[model samples]
Target: MKVLIITYYWPPSGGSGVQRWLKFVKYLQDFGVEPVVYTVENPKYPILDASLEKEIPKNITILKEPIWEPNNILSFFKKENTQQSAGFLNPNPTFFGKILQYIRANYFIPDARKFWIQPSVKYLKKYLSEHKIDAVITSGPPHSLHLIGLELKKALNIKWISDFRDPWTEIDYFEQLPLTKKSIRLHQQLEQEVVEKSDAVLVVGQTMKENFSKFSKNIHVITNGFDNDIDSTSITLDKKFTITHVGLMNADRNPISLWKAISDICNENADFTADYEIQFVGKIASEVRHSLEEYQIKKVLDVGYVSHQEVTKYQQKAQVLLLAVNNVKSAKGVITGKIFEYLQAKRPILAIGPTNGDLAEILKETNAGTIVNFNDVENLKKEILQLYSSFKNGNLESKSNNIEHYHRRNLTEKLAHIIKETVS
Candidate 1:
């Protein structure tokens, strides 16, 4: 069997967006599926890691076409105001920035990547005619990629699967978009169309699957996972009681309660103050920085944008791994990809968000970590103290169980089964 994957993020372009499909492609051949990747030739990627190129399987076909994104033109007007990546919602906007946000929310329709839909559909229509692809899959954030698959399904009548790495209309930042009522309805309409028309809809978490179940019966929950190949044994643990978060810490993801709790703990406990160090390992929003400063937390190490290989090392070294879900209306559904990687690191995890949410469920099931509510400063402080006490006693470790199910290769096997069923 052969599958054609339509994705915006690919190797040489790094971060959580690229990892899911990249790992799927890496392991699919073992399950008797030949993967053909279709991606942008030149993308305005917010983060880049040439190291990820090493993960691409040898002798696989990678198709690329040039994408004309409006962000390229709009970015020139407000270079300082423009976000380096998508999904980082600015809680406060300048007057000019608000104008750009208004245009992006209302005029851009689905996204700035909407411009690539027509051109991609036109290019792929001819290519599909000659190709022996048995099934089509489109992954999105730039949900515009799904429009291409939707069009191809109509034109070529191929078996198409629409994969939601993140929710579209229900995304955390949707409310912050400055969207008009009509624009909001349009987004919902497009989201419904993509879900209902596709042969299958794959989502990263159970909450997403439940949310989209009204639109499509063929929804599947395929969570992002960790590669088993990474060598975790060689990494040396940090001497300090390092609490590290390893991905983009946007304004929404900034755990204010946790910071406040830690600040209070540092002031009250002399031993913790002497040993504890907070480390942020990727692109941090300005708001996150301001919050840290407000707490008067001094021992901060901002090691921005390390390669995937380096990230694994950081994860292994940390005394406690931190996972912060976006404190938004959609917080219950927001399961960031780093959670599984944290599980694989075998370090105790300290997470802050909806305590009754999907992430908390996983942490509870695996016995990998402790979770506190977004505003639960008392419990947050208690959890931190407990982890710190365990660190002092040399008992700081994650007892993650039944975690083989979350290995990258195992997850790919499950994905291949879906592709086979869809094609058949």
Candidate 2:
């Protein structure tokens, strides 16, 4: 089967989002499928982790089109280099940037990718005329990818699959988007259309599937998993009570209360003061920093974002992995993309966020981590001290059974199955 994937995030970019589709494409051929990817040429927001680009399968067809992000144009006038591995325009927009956002919010039919729609629709239509494809799958957060799939399905009669890496309206962080009434309404209408028209819809978790099932009957849950290729050898340490958290750190997911407990414990206990490292890898939110300060935990270390290849090094170094969920009811359904990688690292994880979420369930099932609630600062502090003591006393270890279900190959095979059913 020949499958065309319309996704905004892809390799040369490395973060949790890109890994899903990138790894899916990697294993599609083994399941008797050929994948032709249509992705943005220069994505507006990108964290360039080139280590992941090496995973893109060879001999696969890649269709690239220039995405007209207005923010990029203003950056050009400002003498900014938009092509850096860290993709996209900076968040602190210039005067032109605000105007561009306004136009995108109001003038664009549904999404910011409205500009790319005309070019994508035109280019893809011509390409489809000459080539044969069994299916069309669009994965999105930009959701513009779904628009591309929707158009192609209408014009070419190709079976379409709309994959949501995150929920649309029900997304936990949707409230953070400062969208106008018109933009919100437009977004809802487009979302409804995608849910109704697609032959199949794919989501990351059971909770997301349930949330989406209210909109459409054709929904499936295919959770994210870790890439087996990440080498877990670089930071193999013998004695260090290191706790590590990777990926984006938004204000919501920052466990401020837990930090307070940690700081208090560190201040009171001479043992914790003598041997403990709170190593935060990747981006850190101001809220987390403030909490760390409030707790007087002066030992906070920010090892700025590193390449994907280097992530395993840090993971291997960690005695306990940290998984955080924002303090939201919607977060219960969110099974972060980082958890799988943490699993592959084969370290004892410490989940400190939501108590009832999918992350907790996974940890309980795998016995991979010690789970703690967001508000339970006392218990969180106890767990921290226990883990620290275990590391200090050489007693910390992973007791979880193997979780074969989360292997990337299995997840990709499931993706292939969805494509087969959609095309059939």
Top lDDT model: 1
lDDT of 1 by residue, 273-352 (tens): 99999999998899989998999989999999899988999999999999999989999999999999999998999999
TM-score, candidate 1, is 0.98
Best by TM-score: 1
- What overall lDDT goes with each candidate model? 0.91, 0.78
Per-residue CA lDDT of candidate 2, range 235-260, in tens? 56635567788877767778876677
Error in Å for residue 192 of model 1: 0.4
Clash number for model 1?
0
Error of 1 at 404 (Å): 1.0
Question: On a 0 to 1 TM-score scale, where does candidate 2 land against the true structure?
Answer: 0.90
- Per-model TM against the reference: 0.98, 0.90
Over 4 Å off in model 1, which ranges?
Answer: 80-82
